[model samples]
Structure formats: C-alpha cells, structure tokens
Target: MNYIKNMEQEKALFLANEVTVQAGQIVSKTLAQNPHVSITLFAFGKGEEISSHDSSGDAMVLVLEGTGQFTVDGSEYVLGVGESLIMPAKKPHAVFAKEAFKMLLTVVFPSAT
Candidate 1:
C-alpha cells in the first residue's frame, strides 16, 4: 500500500452486508491503508483457516458474522459475532472459522522512523 502523501486523503464507507462469503474459499478486501495501519475485511468459508503465524505489529479481529476460533500463543478463544480479540505483537496466532464467518481486521504498526 502506498501513502497518498501529497494528495487529500481518500475515504470509503463499507456496508458489512455487502461482503460475501463463498463456499470453500477465503476472501478479503482492504478498505483503508496508510503508513501506520491497515483495515481489511475477510470472509471465511466453513472449515477454512489461516495457519499459525506471527506479526510484528499488533492485530485485532472483530467478528462480524458467525464464529471463529483463535489460538493465540497456545490459548484458545472462541469469538462470535459482535465479539473481538487483540493479538499482541510477536505472538503466535492462528485463525479457524467455526463455521462460515466474517471479520474486520485492523493491524497497527509502529512508526518506521
């Protein structure tokens, strides 16, 4: 993602109902981005998952529909629609769709300078 350094910032409004969930697939849409943070919307089909990984920046997941199982550093947490969780920086994390689910992910990074 590139910074719109010299131009006026761009804004986009998204309706959660418009994000579609496909069978046996995971889809994502990046809504906003900048040097410091990124906001992404994701739809995961039943039994779909993201394998274990760690990020340098802190990340947050807000469940918009259905349920998800998040294993953060070996601790399991089940989050449903309207629930949220914060995964700390440098921690091992994995995501699994309890069924079909949708989430809004926000990752915040420290200043590069």
Candidate 2:
C-alpha cells in the first residue's frame, strides 16, 4: 500500500517547490495521512493566516522558504528559512505568513485507547 501520495517515489526533490504560494490564498499538499500521523506541505501568501485552534496531536513545522509567525498559547515566534517549531497537542496555536512562504508540517497523533 502507498502510505504517501501527491508526490513522486524514489526521487530527489525540494519540498519547498512542492506547493506554490498564491496571492490572497493558502495552498496545501498532503503527502501522507493516517490516524497516527499526517504530513503536509503548505504555501501561504503574504498576510495569510490560520486562526487559533487546538489539535489532538503534536504538530511540528519546518520553514522551507521565507518567514512565518507562529503563536502558541499566546506567545509569538517568528521563524525564517530552515527554522522549526513544535506546537504541543491540546495547546492553542496559530500560523501567519509575514511574507510568501512554504513549510512542511508533520503532526503525530496520540494512540487510541
């Protein structure tokens, strides 16, 4: 079974180029998704944002290009190219793009009882 989709197999590729930033919008490419984990790529236009929300999984983000602002539990952080951050599960978090940027987001969910 293919655990990953929307990408080529056995190829060398840059993650940042997987998605393109569109003016006034956010674009996402989900490479893998299951109950245990989710891997996604995102490109955000300048001033685009994702409103605050909580997740049931711990989310990690790696900046592939440009800059992004992350707010976790009311604290703010600005990340540039190659930077990464983790947002703990159950804590509120939000993401904003100060300029056009691309990122890889991996979320690991808790196991079911």
Candidate 3:
C-alpha cells in the first residue's frame, strides 16, 4: 500500500499503509523529493532515536502513531498521535521514540520560503 497521503494524487491511500515500525529497527520511505521540499515517512522502534542535527530547511514532524520525544533548539517536547511540531531551519533537533512510532516528515528548503 502506498502511504503517501499527498503524493501520487492520481490515486488515494492512507498514511497508515505506507510504512511500519519493527522491533529494533527503523523504517522509512520517501514519498517525494525536490529542491523546494521533501516528504518522507519514518517508523521508529521503541527506545530508538535519531541524533541531534541541524537542518538547512524547516522540518515538520507529524506523529501518526505511538509517542515521540523531540528536542528542538534545546527544548524538549513530547508528542502523541496526531501531534505535530516544526523544527526551524538551522536549529538543533533530535527525535527519540519512547514507544514504537510512525510519523510523516515534511522539510521545506530555504529556496521554497
């Protein structure tokens, strides 16, 4: 199933169908990519995390399942299903999964703003 909600608009599919979280592993899928923006899906297993990093583009994470703890610019935010947060361009950020989780990530490059 194609889980990219906004991409491949010629057809329709649910976000839950795109990718799945697994034991001790992280999964991801790229729905679209361009100079202006990129759409991707990520599934993180419990206790998994992505190291802190800075992005040239503004990145938004939309939680689709379970829970995630986000550190953006030195502040921590805990999000559950349906929650979303934007990490601004050039800011330090990291993501940690307290539980198995899934999310849609949209990054908008500087040129697009």
Query: Each model's TM-score, in the order given?
Result: 0.85, 0.98, 0.88
lDDT values, one for every candidate: 0.86, 0.97, 0.90
Best of the two (2, 3) by TM-score: 2
Looking at model 2, the pairs that clash are none
The numbered model that scores best in lDDT is 2
Candidate 2 lDDT over residue span 7-105, tens digit each: 999999999989999999999999999999999999999999999999999999999999999999999999999999999999999999999999999
Residue lDDT tens for model 1, 1-113: 45432223564644456478998999888867777887888899999999999987899999999999999999999999889999998999999988999998999988897
Highest TM-score: which candidate? 2
Per-residue lDDT of candidate 3, residues 1-113 (tens digit): 55544456676677867788898988988887878888999999999999999999999999998999999989999999999999999999999999999999999998743
Which should have the higher TM-score, number 1 or number 2?
2
TM-score, model 1 to reference? 0.85
Clashing pairs in 1: none
Candidate 1 regions exceeding 4 Å error are 1-14
- Candidate 3 ranges beyond 4 A from true positions: 1-9
What is the full ranking by TM-score, best candidate first? 2, 3, 1
